[model samples]
Target: MSWLRPQDVVEKALAASTADAQVTYVVESSEANLRWAGNSLTTNGSMRSRQVVVISFVDGGAGMATGTVARTGSPDVAELVAASEQAARDAGPAEDAVPLVAEPPPGAGEWDADAAETSIGVFTDVAPALAEAFGEARGREELLFGYAEHAMATTYLGTSTGLRLRHDQPAGRVELNGKSADMSRSVWAGVGTRDFADVSVADLAGEVARKLAWSRRRVELPAARYETLLPPSAISDLMIYAYWTMEARDADEGRNVYAKAGGGNRVGERLAALPLTLRSDPFAPGLEACPFQVVGGSSGSASVFDNGMATPAVDWISGGVLTNLIRPRAWALNTTAPATAAVDNLLLESPGATATQDEMVAATERGLLLTTLWYIREVDPQTLLLTGLTRDGVFLVEGGEVTGAVNNFRFNESPVDLLGRITEAGRTERTLPREWSDWFTRAAMPTVRVPDFNMSSVSPAS
Candidate 1:
């Protein structure tokens, strides 16, 4: 649908709202996708939806109800508004109710015409090249599986208070997993980019093939602490966990890793020894994101009921110091602090000489090379300790070269601790984590060398 249609839907929802209630409409429309498996395309699908949410304020209580409609259907705005009003009458008072945004900040309705008009032909044109790459696999024992998705989504937010916001995001991702016949060895390589031209299926296929060849002979090593080299993919995983713990309220409440030792939060403390900087900027080149973050509603600033809260470049860590933490508007107001929103992308930067993954491996006298992490889960919030298994590819380095593929192992480590122990850092590049790629897609991570990385146990899975 064109931009005018989405605006009309929002206007209808607003016109249906009662005097005592505030209505907000959110419309999202996405293009079709293609799914692939076993080296072939499998399914094609598309999704287009719109939802209208009404917030009724009565007797200090606020209640919300959402009504949804598909692309081919009409919305029941009146019924949804009535339901929300009734719910407010039946519920208790809202303790943290704030008025809806009266006026949206400037630049709320910025539009990217190119992104909004992305077509399905982009995926169709690339499918043949991807298939050809897969067919180039050497042996019959090798198998391939993954998906290619092209999506163009527009989010429109309109409030009864006259706040209007809209953003169009175009995204494309290609993931490929290759494995040997016996499932004894495997490798994963993929690309996620807003521009389809950036995704090179040939390079992805070559990397998988190279890694699979390196894993033909397996070597078993007893679990022990060792110096380790982590590629961008593995480092991106650590950064994601670090960002999740940057909530200001959690730290102020004395429950998160950033809680102070005595009193107050650890905002100014030096968290790592290395001069590392982690930041987020919506306008960052090659990693652009929406200019505004969602605010208000039950989920606070994380809500999809966006209120046009402008997102600016935020420095979470600078020069290895704890610099800033994300704060929801409600919590910020209650505590007399500045409101901040969590960012969609993260960038990790280090100074001095930059090296590539291969160069980092060549410099390491003895260490383990981790391709990526899998099934990572938090073990301790205070220390930011995490546990996960190494998968896809793991190797042992001897004499500044990868000697052999090592058995998978479960590792217990913390991003915070890892940064503090960093012996070297290489050049940063946009990378996708094995896990959490769906959410944290944009990251420029570097190869990191850490001493005494804890490998806790062995895993039988490749």
Candidate 2:
């Protein structure tokens, strides 16, 4: 749907509303997805939907209701609005009431024509090449599996507060999992990008083949502390955990890693010893994200009392010191502190000379090279300790060379601790963390070398 139609529908909904009511209409339209397994395409489809959410404040009580309709179908905007207003009147008074305010949205010229106007033909044209790549790998006696997807979505958000926002996002991903014929070794390699032209099927296949070849011979290593070399993929996952733990309210409440020993939060504490910096910027090249975040909704669901809060470039960590934290609107109002939205994209900067992953490995005298991490779960929020398994590929490096592949091991570490012990920092690149790629796709990470990394135990699964 064009911008004009959604805007018109929103205007109509607002005009039909009574006093003390606010409404937001969000319309999303996109073409997406091609799933493949066992080296063959299995399913493909597209979707377009629009949802109208109403928030009503009657006599200090708040109520919210949402109605959705397919873009191809007729919708009853008036009926939906009435139902929401009635729900509000039936509800009780809210515990915390914060006034809703409108903020300026992105400029009209901010839309990317290439992203907004992407054609389904792009996927159709690429599927054949990907399939052929899979076939070629399978013929060489390797088991290959994964999925490819292309999506272009335009989100239109309009509120009664005179806030009108529109953003068009284009995303593509190619994930491949390859294993040896005997199932003794495996590796994961993929690409995530906003442009279809950047995904090279041949290069993806080659990467898997090369890793699988490296794992042809395996070595057994007992669980022990080793000097570890973490690639960008591994770094991305750890950084994601750090991002989620940046809640200011939780820290101030003394339930988070950022909490201080006595009273208050650790905003200015030196959490790491290295010259590390972490920040989020929606306008960052190759890692753009939505400029606004929706806040104050019901737990685990989109809130009827939602606010399209503008997100600013946040300097979360700088010069090894805790610089900032995420501040929700309600919490900010209660504490009289500044409000900022959590970021969808994360960027980690390494000071001084930047080395490539291969260069980092070459400089390592003895260490473990971790390709990816999986099943990550938080063990302790106070120390930011986490437990997870090294996956895809684990190699033993000796005398500045990868001697042989090693058994996978479970690890216990924290991103904060890792940063504090960083001996060297290497080149940074846009990476897709295996855990949060579905939601947080834009990340710029660097290869890092740590002096002592805890490898807890050997894992049976390869």
Alpha carbon lDDT of each predicted model = 0.74, 0.74
Task: Estimate, for each residue in 126-154, the C-alpha lDDT of model 2 and write its tens digit.
Answer: 68887787788779888777877666666
lDDT of each residue in 440-460, candidate 1, tens digit only: 787888888888989999988
Badly placed stretches (over 4 Å) of model 2 are: 1-4, 38-43, 61-75, 90-96, 106-119, 296-306
Error of 1 at 313 (Å): 1.1
TM-score of each: 0.90, 0.88
Off by over 4 Å in 1: 1-4, 19-23, 56-73, 110-119, 139-141, 295-297, 300-306
The ten-residue window of minimal lDDT in model 2 covers: 64-73
Clashes of each: 0, 1
